[model samples]
Structures are given as structure tokens and as C-alpha cells.
Target: MGCKSCGSGTNEDGTPKGCGSKGACNTSSCNQRSTYDWLSDLGIDDPYAASIVEVSFKNGASKDFYYAPSELEVFTGDNVAVETKNGYNVGRITLSGELVRLQMKKKKVREEKVTESIIRRANTRDMERLAEVRDMERSTLVKARAIARSNHSKMKITDVEFQGDGKKATIYYTCDERVDFRELVRQFSHQFRIKIEMRQIGPRQESARLGGIGSCGRELCCSTWLSDFSSVNTAAARYQNIAINQAKLSGQCGRLKCCLNYELDTYMEALEVFPKKADKLRTEAGLAILIKTDIFKGIMYYTYKENRGLLYPIPVAKVHEILAMNKAGDKPIDLQSNQLVVEEKDDVFGYEDVTGAIELPAEKRRKKRRKKKSGTNAKGRSSGSGRKPASGDSRAKTGEAKTSNTGDKPAAGGETKEGSRSSKRRRGRSNNRNKKRGENASAGPKASSGGGDKPANKPSTPKPTGEGGKGGSSSSGRKKRTPRRKKRGGDAPKGD
Candidate 1:
């Protein structure tokens, strides 16, 4: 018997060692139905002449009740030979003493019904024979499956177990429907030259016999200690608020996970207080649809039809009250108005709201400002505040006047002087308007430039000259006019 659970290798005498007890075999930790014989531990003498013992074969894959003869001294974890259908089979004693009676009652096996008796404590010869049979199981299983497939049997052969004496073999298989394996069994018997017994089991049983790790990262419960499997369905998942995903819900057995039923009763009891048909709550805002439920917290989440992503967590008692009101044909003002409000204290050092303070970098801000300025200019032009100059005739006339007046001045300072005088004129005009409107004089120039309406085009006024003559007066006026012409020409086509 190989203890796959503990990964304990076989001893030199061919018997499995330790039973995965981890030095706790005395505490009855090896088999699934472990029984700590406290009476034997207390040194209490046996009261019965013969006691029923539970012997497990194939590493607890199969177990049977055997009558222990008073003549043979046996204990739990001891290797013993037991009577089978044909010859004797060797197995480990899993249960002994008074606990054996309780285990038999649990399994519904009566004392008189268990006619099989332990033949003897396994000796060296028996251990060697058992090891030989165990070694032949793998090859026999492969050959049996091939024979079944060749015979066109609609069955999956999962495992094969040989008798200790090598005179018999048990073939375990799984099939969705009833399968007649009479011919298949006959082929196995002839090919292997042993008595063949075919056993049909469900997917869960097959997985238990062929044990492996489950999705929970542990050995399969059925293979370890779960001798009985309860019916598991989607209802268990629904009760526990688990998503209905086939791959997640189904276990290695291709059925709903058995663990689903573990907390199902608690979930059922918790949900009983919840209002029935309360999935949709009537409200003045709209029909509030139920999203999900938190059974432990006693909270149900609901969202209105018009508003999404805003879940209102209502207590179970309040939900029932609302449902009762709805039954009486009264609608609540809003779901939130009746919801349970859990006050959360603000953390002084927690993350502050930076939404309003957030600003773009300087380069990005400059770009945005330029974009706004261009858009405003476009709007101003469209609204008739500024019109495109059709031709350069107005510019030519002013340019000629400036050339004649500034002909004597040095070219270096003439442009700068002209620009300064134009700016002064603009400021003067804005200041005069601000005085008339009674507005702040300091803001006038900025207001004129920043406003959607551009400044009105006005003729430049000549500066007073020291030499009071007709030619001097005209030339001074011409100098002022030249700068305006240059400014107008700046907007002309590049070719000009």
C-alpha cells in the first residue's frame, strides 16, 4: 500500500511506512476514519472476545470491515491478511477497538453481516507477494484500457488494483451511461490470466481513486478525508454570491465544487431575513435595480435607472420596510433618502483634493492662451470689428509722406522713434476714453488691447515743432503718418 497523501516510500520489508502520520501514527492520523483508542491507551483490557476491524487496501482507496479473530493479535496501522471474495488480500488495519463499532454503524455495516475475517498478520512472504502484485497494477491497467478500447467499449478505465496473491484484479471505470463490459472483462481475464471484476463509478469517485491536487491547492477532498459527497449545484453558488462561471465553479470532477455546500446553510439562514421580490425598489427617481448583496454585512446595493455607478447600500431592515411600503402602493422619494448612511471620519493627513489647484505646465498654458487669442481674433473679425484691407493704396500714400519727412534723419533711430510715438498716441486715446467713461485710467490700455473689439483707426496727430513754418509743420505730421503705413503694410501678402 503506497501512501500517496504523505508521499511516504515503501519500507525494505515491502510494507508502507509512516502512513503520513508525521510521527503521530499513535494519535490515529493515518486513515480518514482515524480512531484514537483511549481505552487501549489507558491500558484497559478488552471486554469483547472478538472485535470488528476496518482494513483499507490500495492506500485507503477501498476499505472493508473484517472480523478480527481473538487468536490473532492485531492493532491499527498493522499489516494484516484479510479474506476477500476468492483468496486472501493484504491491507493495513485502519480502525480497531470500540471505535470500530461506531465506524461500522456510520457505514451501516452490521457485525453479523461482516463474515470476512483477518486471515493473519502479514509475514515477510506475504509482504513480498503484495509488493509484486502492486508493481503489476500499472502495466495491467494500461493493457486493460487498450483491450476495452479495442473491444469498442464506451467506458474510461481509470485505475486497476490487483489482489495480494495476484489471483484477482479489480478494474475501476467511469461512463456516462450504462456500459456492458462483459466481453471486455472476459478479455482482461484471458489476457491477464486472473479473475477480473469490473467496477463502474462516477466522475467524483474516479477522481478520488486517481488522486491529484485540486484548484484549492490541496489534495482532493474526496481522496483525502471526504468519504461522502453531498450534492452541489448552482444554488449554492448563488446563495454565496459567487459568480456563475463554469470554469471557476466546476472542480476536477467536472461537477460543481463540493466546497460550495460548506457555507451554503449559513448563507441561506442569513438571506431568510431579506425581503422577497425586493430586487427592484420603487422610488420617485426611478426603479432602483439591485446590483449585488453583502450577506454578512447585511447590506444590499441598488442603483437608479437614470443614475449609474452610484450604488446605494441599504440595510436589510430598511429594505424590508421599503418593500412593505411599496406593497401598500407608496413610493419612496428616493433610494438614497432611505439608505443607511455610514459616517466616515475625514483623515486630516490623507490625500487632499487637488482638482481645482491642478494646472498645466508653462509651455502648455502659453499654447492654450495663444489658441484663445487666435479664436477671439477670428470672432472679432467675423463680427465686423476688423475687416481685411482690400489693397495697399492707403499704405503707399502714407509711405511716400514718411520718406520725404524722414529723408534728413539718420536711419538707425528713425524706426524706433516712429514706433514709440505710435504707442504714445494709442495710450493717449485710451486715456482720453477712460476719463470720459470714468473708469480706472491704469486699466485703459490693457482693456483696449484685450477686449474683443479692436481699437478704432484714427489719423495720427502731428507733434508741435520749434520752427513755426508751413513746411516744418507739414513734415512733422508726415513723420507721424509714416509709422501707421508701415504697421498696415505688415499685414500685406509676403510677396509685397
Candidate 2:
């Protein structure tokens, strides 16, 4: 297997064997920033190529210029062991040949400052060690964070990197202000038992190093291709008519989104076409003031100074004409016009028309009316018990009616002087009707007969005990009630 940076290596049998489809995939990915060597692919070799090679560490997290040996022939995607002051580090070669010279010059890195050089190409053993160190980076980061915490250092550890030989580690941290590094480094070095590097970076740089998807649903520009970060301000949003909402306007860096400045120049150019000194227009109806501008549509929206609820859109040419008319001592009738109305699309395609179609019946609860307090009538007697009397008791019903007609007061000890009888137990409506009929029949005979005299057909009061259909001694607590006989026409009172 070889580094498949160029995607153009071969096998011994003359068949393609590199990272292409013709061969088995032996791609040891080294390309992170996606660079292509145009000269190498074209089979062109420059006689005056730079000796300095650009090596990327941590898959393009960082890049440093290293002097390449004249004798060593580096291939695409080749991993090289570079010389650091502490130990050797492994990195992939991203740039070589004269292009590297141009990169160095563009970065303004002087050749004399380039002190380190490539020792040799990464062999099997070096790669194995490189993998081992890379695996330890996560654990190393956790331990470094713990160490920094133990030291009470005011810094956030973002990432950790280990040398190929595992002899040194670089800890990337972020801090707002200067920190006391002497104590932190002493503790870290003793704890890890290796050379400790405290590298500081900004919040944006931290996000760039640790790549992630952005709010735009794509890879971060910083991690993908954007290398330079410039200042962004709210003026960019204002020029484009965007709302000044902090949450939507800011990116993951807690700063104004870089995309805000992408089309800012175009917006600025468009804004220049808007007329100046046209914030107000004098009219006979009232004074109208400019509210906003539609740069592309060439419309300027204005509102009456007294009525801001309605907006009137006037063409740029019409606005200029009005300004000229005003300058010539003339005034328009009013700001309102047919063009002031902005038509909005009434039909939305994606959503279902569910308005008033789905009805949910509201739950209705019947409120129980409060029962009026029962009290005695004008006479000093209880109308009924604390509840409703039996339906057959005609006397009790009459008393209750009289009690209600008069303002009854409560009796002593009882809940009220006369509590109206609400049904104490459940009873059938038929039973109540039958009881009322019996009460009517019994009342008719009683009313016809004389008041004090007993009726002839009525049964007499029982003696001590009546049995065997004859008057006799009664049994104790076991006597059965006799059924009432129906009244006959012959038994009717003579008065009727």
C-alpha cells in the first residue's frame, strides 16, 4: 500500500494498482485541503524547483515549510518524518516543486527562517508509531484538560497532538487574556512525562481545526476553503434589508456570519442608485416620510407622518418628479395611490386547507344549582324534616307549600327551621304518580264527610292482636300490613 495523494500509482504486472478503480483501494488518505499537482499530472518537470517542501500536519490542521533533501524523491501523498526541536514528527506532503516556492513567497515566509528539514520518508515502523500516537491524542487531550484544571489555569484546552515518536505533545488552548503558563507547564510536563507545548488559538481557529457542519447545512467555510477571516459588521445586514436579529445573524463563531459580507458590495452598489435628500415628501393631504427602499424594484416606500400603519410605494422616477415639483413650489394632492397596495399570494401550495374542516366539540359541564336553605313558615312548627317527606304525605306537602309561600326561618337544632324535602332515596316516577292518585282518592272522601266524624268504609284502629280474619291478640314485631281495598261507588258520601 502507498499514499494515494495523486491517485496514479501502479502494480508490477503493468496493471493499475494505485488509488484508482483499476486497482484495489490501498488509499492511505493524506489529502485534507484538496490540493492537486497540475505539473506532476501533466508529466512536466521544472528544472528550477524549490528545495523547500510544504508538509501538512494533522490532515491540514497546520502546515509548515520544511527543507527537502536533494537525494530523496517524494511521491504524492508521501508521509515524511520532519525534524522538530523536541523530536521527529510525521506529516503528509501537500505541496512540492516550484509551486511550494510561490506558496512560501505568498505567505511571506522568508527562506532563512525555514530552519527545519525532512529527515526521511515515513517507513512501516514510523507509520505504525504514528498511528499509535494518533490514537493516544484523544486520551492525551482529556489528561491535559485535567492537568490544566488541577493547575486552575484559566484556559480551555481544544485539542492535543502527539509527535511521531510520542516524545512531545502540543496542547492547543484558548484564553481571553494572558495566563500564568509557568506553573501550568511544569505540572503538565511532570504529569505527562513528555515535552508539553502550550499553543494558543482563537475561537474561530478552534472551530476551523475541529470541523463540523454549519447552520447553512454544509461544511464550514473555514474548514473547507476559507482560510482568511475578516471583520463583519451590522452595516452589511442593514444595506441588504436584513433584520438585526443576533441569533440568526451570528455564526458558530458567535460573530456576524461571513456570508453577510458575500453580497454586501452588490447591495452597496444598488443602494447608491436611491435618491438622496428624499426622506420626506410634502402633500396637500399630509406629510409623507420615506420608510424603506426596494433597491431592485426601484420603488421607495413612504408613510404619512400622521398615519404610519399604511405604506405607499412610489416609483423612483415618480419620487424624483415629486421632488422637482416641490422645489418648484407645487404640492401633490395626497400620498395614497393604487400602487400602494402590495399583493400577497393567497394560495399556499404545500399545506392542506383544514380551516373550519376539522371541528373539535368543546366539553360542556352542567353546573349544579345551589339548593335554597329550608326554614320554618310563619307558624312555630317544622314543615318537614332536614330532607323531603315521602311523596304520599299530603299534609307534609301542604305544609311545605305554606312554608315556601311565607319567608321561613330555621328551626332549633335542625339544619334549617324547615328543610324542603329533596328525595332521600331513588324512587320511580310511576310510584310517585300512584301515590298521588291514592292521596287524591283518600282526600275526596274525607272532604265529602264531616270533618270530625270517621268514614263508614274506613277500617277501624286495630285492637291488641287480630288474626285468622278476626280480632285477636297481635304477634310481636311480626305483623304483616293489610292491603288497602279499593273504594266502591256505593260507599260514596251522601253529600256527593
Candidate 3:
């Protein structure tokens, strides 16, 4: 028989012997052992060997593969040979029986098609060779891009993954359209001695591969559960009333975000009860267009012609009533005329001419003129009283004559009385008095009336003007006086 991993010789009972190549031979059966045949062949019933539960197909049933009881412990990331319907195909152990069953249920695979038997386990040499292939992937990418650039291809080199056997590497790239990467694959295989596969992806898949947090603060759905990308359009924006210019409404793809459609049905349902702005309504004076409406507020503004053709505001409820009346073929009542505010009329008798007719202007004039005329009359009355009285004039004239008559008489009488009394007293005192004591007389030696007397020496007085003891005016004796008017230098000679 042919070996599953490397196409080499097999043992009897259709079991694979050792594989042919380095990565190819690690999982081969070193000893040919069927299910439940390990302990007996080893010559000891050692209980340390774990019993094999099942063998699982890693890549599914296009290849023939199997694993032995001891190889059941092989996990994912461990390269293993899995038995398929035909030849053995090798894949990493991505899942076991229970998980594979679930995956089968998810993929709806038939129960008989699933392989649940192990062949053998991976050894050290297999792991080391896989690491060698991983180490080669980085350098292979640089050479691949250079090859693509030489061919003038617009394809991008995103990532490279080597198969477990080191026979093939898959290259992921993004391009605007289909790319002919046949030359790139040829160059890669020639340079690296391996098969090459190119995979194309979109911006969303590129974002998922790079891994990012979305605007909603979560891992991208494409990286999580979303394997399919649906087309998002701006129509979703119109349905949700989202402003088309808002950056949040656009996603990293520069298109309307997919989340806008998530709640569109709810908004559409809410919009059903709203009134459209297309309807027209009439008013008493003129027509008004329906501009906008607040649905929740149940209010709308209507414009109608008023003074000077300017539109005035009215409510929607009022417009609806008017529209209803118009539909009923009845003209709307002019509430503006009927509801005019009528002022109460005043009694003519009680109304004191506020308009200030005939006598009013005169009355105002009289009020202004009264102050002047009264002030003039008061000035005239006061001026009449302030005039000197004729009695006062007569008394002033008579008192002037009396003052002239009494002026000499009072002077002569006072002089006669003073002279007579002084002369009589002087005679009486001279007749009754004795000589004063010498000490008393001498105590005031400079007296005028006592016996001891001496005349005080006096300075000569200045002579008076034009009198018995005065002199004729001299240049130095005249008082200095200022002239009343300035003396003119010259005058026009008798008015020319």
C-alpha cells in the first residue's frame, strides 16, 4: 500500500509505514498497529497509554487518512495524517470528534462520512521542520513583492502562511480587480522551492485581518462572526433620517455604515402616523405653503397675507378648520372682522372736550398769558405802592425847613447851658477849697489844674491851607489827585 503522508511503502493489513520526507514522515506509523492493538504489540500491558476515543478528519473526505489509538492525543497546531474515503490527506488537528460533530451539524454533514480514527502522533523532527518553513515565510514575502513590482502589478502583499508540510504557502492580497498572479506564483515557487496560492480580499477583510475596534467600541464583526459583507447604500441613511454628511454615519470603508439599517424598520414604523408636508391649505386673506412640520409637537406654521402683503403666522389647527369649511363648500367666517375689539362709547355730556376745541387753545393760551398778565398787574400794583407818598414828601420838605431852623438854635442853647454851669461850679469850688498838702500837690507835679503844674513841650504843627494859621498853596503841599478822563493826544481838526 502507499503511505498517506509521503506516498511511500506500507505494511500488511493496509497500514502506512514510515513517511518519505522530513515534514512528511513525522506522523507516520513506526509500527503497524490497528485500533486497540498498541499494548499487546509492545509486549507489556502498560496502563499509562491512553485509550483512543476517535480519529477525526481535519480537512474532510476528499483524501484517505487515519490515526492510531496513541495519535488521538494530537491537538490542533500539531500536524497529523487524517484518513479520508480515498487516499490519506494531511491537515492540522483543528478539531476532535465532539467539536467535529458540532461542525458537521453546522455544515450538515452526513454521519457516515465523518472519520473518527487516529493514525499516529507527531514527533520532534516534524515540529522543527514546520518551524523552518515558518521562518522562511518572512523572507519569501520580500522576494514576492519584488517579483510583483517587476511585473508592474498593483497587487498588495498582506500575509503569507505556510502549509504544515512546507510544500505550499498561501498569499493574501487586496486588489481593485482580478489579478493575473501566475508569474508571481511561478517566481515564488522557483525562489522558495514550494507551491504558491494567492487569495484576494476586500477592505473589510483587510481590516479584520489587521484587527481593529469599530466605532461602536467593539471588535469588528468581520473579525468575529460576519463572514459575509452585505452592500450598504445611502438609501439606508434616508430611511433613518441620518445626515449624509455626518462622519459617524459613514464607516471606515467610506460608505454608509452598515449599522444604519439595524434600526431602520422602527423609524419607518414610527413615520407611518406622521403627516406629509405636501398638503395645501387656504386662509382668509391668501395662500401659504407648508414648509415643515413638527410631528410630535402637532404644530405647524401657516403664512397668510396681512398688512402690506406680508405673510402672518397661524396655527395648523386653525388652518385645518378653515380647510374643513372650504371642503364643505362654506366660506370661512372672517374672524378678524367679527372678533375686532370694540371700544366702549363715552357720553357726550360727560365728555369734557379732550380734543380741546374753541375755548381749549384759548384756555391754554390764557393759562400761559395769565402768568404774564398777572405778573404785569402785580408789578404795576407793587410799583404803585413803592412810589414815595405825597405825605412823606411834604414831611421831608417840612423836616428840611425845621432842621435848618433848629440847627442854630440848638447850638446856641447847648453852648449857653455848658458855659453857665461850668462857670458857676468853678466859682463855688474856688470859694470852699483850702490849699492842698504839699506832698499831695507835688505827688502829681505835671497837673493842669492843681498848684504844681508844668506845660508839656509840643512839636510845631504843620500850617493849614487858606486860613488865619494857613498858608497859600505850595507845589509840595497840594494833594495828588487822579484826573477823571484820560487826556487825548490829538483830535481831528474840527471834523476835518
Candidate 4:
């Protein structure tokens, strides 16, 4: 028979070996508390040593001490049938030898009160009966819950367990108030044909019996190693400076998480040196109110009453000094008088603030457009006596003309050459205009009167006309010749 405690198979003598009460498993996987019998390993000093043993039932949910007869030779992990009030009960031996004494003392169980004795190692028939009883527990639990609900009972049935003999069943439940299930038990016994026992438990005990995963992504402490439940409240959360949100603080048991108490002692010890009545500090500007306390860093945050939004962190010692000064009828000039200076640590990669240093390629495009607007205005004034197109005027017509002449498939090299020539012409016109304007200014009224009229007509530059004529003639010829080639090809086909 395989031991249910550790799930290990039969030992060499065909007896089951459970997780020995050594507080550890032989395989090192089971975390259920087991005792290591160092006395057995070192050899028992007396062969007739007191054979008081600890046995666990229902996989350690319940445990009790049993007297083992010396002649039976029972060991840890041996499934044994023990005597109970009704008939007999079966459990796996978890501890033996000198270790059982220490375990009893830890649990405050007296050896003389342990009247139960192991009858014999569970035989094949006994093991089979235990398996049958174990299968009935689930269905029994569901039916018991329905019975309780149908009868309008306030109790919540959490779990059910049947004795190995299949003679009795224990129903575990939780409720806010006491429930008298006297009639409910009569109905359950009639339905299941067994002795019914109702055991009332707390919410935490119910959660432990019905195991579940906690928010920490591990098995619940109540279900795993934590056997005792301590009172957890919002005070533990306040000491740790945790938010008082109920949903965040609650655990699987719908109570404040037990983990909140784990680190509370450390927080309390660190907060001891902080001043208690330093909630408000007097300053020349205004009264600074306490915002928060950083126990680890020994800093206290305070904000001016006039400007509650702005907070300044002051060292614990400095805050005490300021408070002492205020108590003595003197106030500091400002809350910042004892401000804490936090040193900046250099990053491993030498991090830099490049928020302002980022330069987008699109910004260069915007600058190019602005420069083009200014240049075009200057060119228009110099060439055509300031008769320039409005800024909103569409340049699409000229752009379309270029696109049509180029057939939208112009070579990249050809486009670059054309662009360079146009730029050169604009530069040349600008320079010539500049020279004329300077000469007019130096030559006074005579030069202006004589040259102004001539320059006005000279606005019709040969460079633009020459370039326009070339593009127009080439486009017109290409359009005219394409139809003639199609006509010639059509005529040849008809003649053939």
C-alpha cells in the first residue's frame, strides 16, 4: 500500500512508508512537517524504549499520538489501523522513537493521555476499505451543503471526511453565528446511513482545509506551513505605510493578509527615532504640515500650509532641531532651512538628458520652407519691381507642367542637373540685381532716373524663356510623334 502522506510506495517489508515525522520527506519534495529520529539512526539505547508514536490522518489535517506495541515493530510511514471509540481508524505513522516525545511537548500533548494504540499494520483489505471511504467524501460534502441550504441553515459546509471504517463522517463548516444543526444531522444520517458529526470552524480554518493559491503566486501560508492564525488588522498596513484599500489588503480568507505582519516589526523599529508630534512645523513664511515619513531613509516630507502641493524632504535630525526651535518661541525662515540633500549616483552607461537634444529630420524641412519663402520674395522684388505672388497662391500649375514634360519617369541624374541649373540662374539674377541697386545708390538721382526704366523691362529674363521654350518644344514634339507611329503601325497591318 502506498502511504497517502508522502505518496511513497511500500517499504522493503511490504509496509507503507510515509513522510517520516522528521519534518522533512525522504525525497525532499514534501514540505509537511516530519520528525527525524536521530535516536533510531544512532541505535536505540534500550530495546524496550517507550513506543509512543505520532500518526496523521487525512494527510496531516489531523494528527494524534498512538501507543505502538514493541512486538509489532511499527515504523514511520507504516499505515496502521488504530483503535477508535466506534471501531477502528487507519492512519500513517509520521513519527517514532525519541522525536515523538519532543513533538508531543511542542504540541503540549501528554504521553499518559495517549490511550490509543496501533492494532496492526493495515492489510490489503483495510487499505481497500480506506480508499472506498476516501471516494465518498466529495459527494458527501456536496450533499451536506445542499441539505444545509435546503433547510435554511446559516452555516457554510466547507469539507467532509469519512473514517477508514466507513462508519462515521465529519462535516466541517464556518458561520458568523452559532448554528444548531440537530435536525440537519438527522436528515444527513438517514440519507448517508452513517453517524454524522458537524464541526464548526472559522473562516481561516475553512480556507486552510480547502487549499488555494494566494496572491503571492504560491500556496497559501494557512494551507502550507502556517498552523496558527494571528490577528491581522489595518494597523499593520498603516505601520508599513500601505494604502488602506480593503480589496488590496484582503487575502484568500477575506481577512487582512497575514503577510502584512511579516515586515511590520522592522518598520516599527526603524520609526522609533522619528518625532511623534512633528506633524506641523512653524516657519517665518508659513506653517509646514507633515506629508509622509521615510523611516528607512530617516527623512520627513513637509509642505507649506500656503502651498500644500509643494513638499520638501527634511532629515529626521534636522526636523527635530526645527521643531525644538519652534517650541522655544522661534521659527525657521523656511521649511527648506533643513532640507535634505540627496546625492545623485552616476549611471553605469553614463545616461544623459537628451530630451532637448533630439533633432528631427522634419524640422530641417520646415526651416527649408521658411528660407524658400524669404528667398522667393527677395527674388521677386529684385526681378519684377516687387510684384510678387501672394504666399497662398498655388505653385501647382508650374509643378504640373514640369511633371507632364518629364512623364513622371525622369532619370534621377537628369533631375539633379536640372535643379542645379535653375538654382544657378536664380543666384545669377539675384547677384545682378544687387550690383545694379548698389550702383544706383552710389550714382545718386541721375543713375536711378536713367537705369530704373531700363531695368523694369529687363525683368523678362532670357534664361527663363529659353528654359521654358526648350521644355515646351520637346513635350509638344513627343506628343505629336507618338500618334504618327501608332497610325503607321495600323496602316501597315491593313495593307498586309
Candidate 4 ranges with C-alpha deviation above 4 Å: 1-50, 97-102, 346-496
RMSD of each: 15.5, 13.8, 32.1, 15.6
lDDT of 1: 0.67
- For each candidate, what TM-score against the reference? 0.63, 0.63, 0.39, 0.63
The Cα RMSD in angstroms, rounded to one decimal, for candidate 2 relative to the true structure is 13.8
Better of 2 and 4 by lDDT: 4
Clashing pairs in 4: 18-77, 21-34, 21-35, 21-94, 22-34, 22-35, 22-36, 23-34, 23-35
Worst 10 residues of 4 by lDDT: 442-451
Give the per-residue lDDT digits (tens) of candidate 4, residues 1-496: 4454456676675544533332223532233433445554443464556689888777666778999998998776677899999988888776787778778888898987999899998987997899899998989888888888999999989999889899989898889998888999899999999998889888888877787888889878777667578899899999888989999999888988988989999999998999989989998989899998888999899998888877899999998899899889998899766798778878667689897799656543343443222123232443312222345442221332133233334221122111233433443344344545442211111111111212221112111223244212132233211111123344542100
Error of 3 at 6 (Å): 31
C-alpha local distance difference test of each model: 0.67, 0.67, 0.45, 0.67
What residue pairs are clashing in model 2? 375-418, 387-421, 388-421, 388-422, 410-417, 411-417, 465-472, 465-473, 465-474
Model 3, position 99: C-alpha lDDT score: 38
Q: Candidate 1 lDDT, tens digit per residue, 309-334? A: 79999999989988988899998999
| TM-score computed on alpha carbons, candidate 4 | 0.63
Model 3: lDDT equals: 0.45
Model 2 lDDT at residue 240:
95
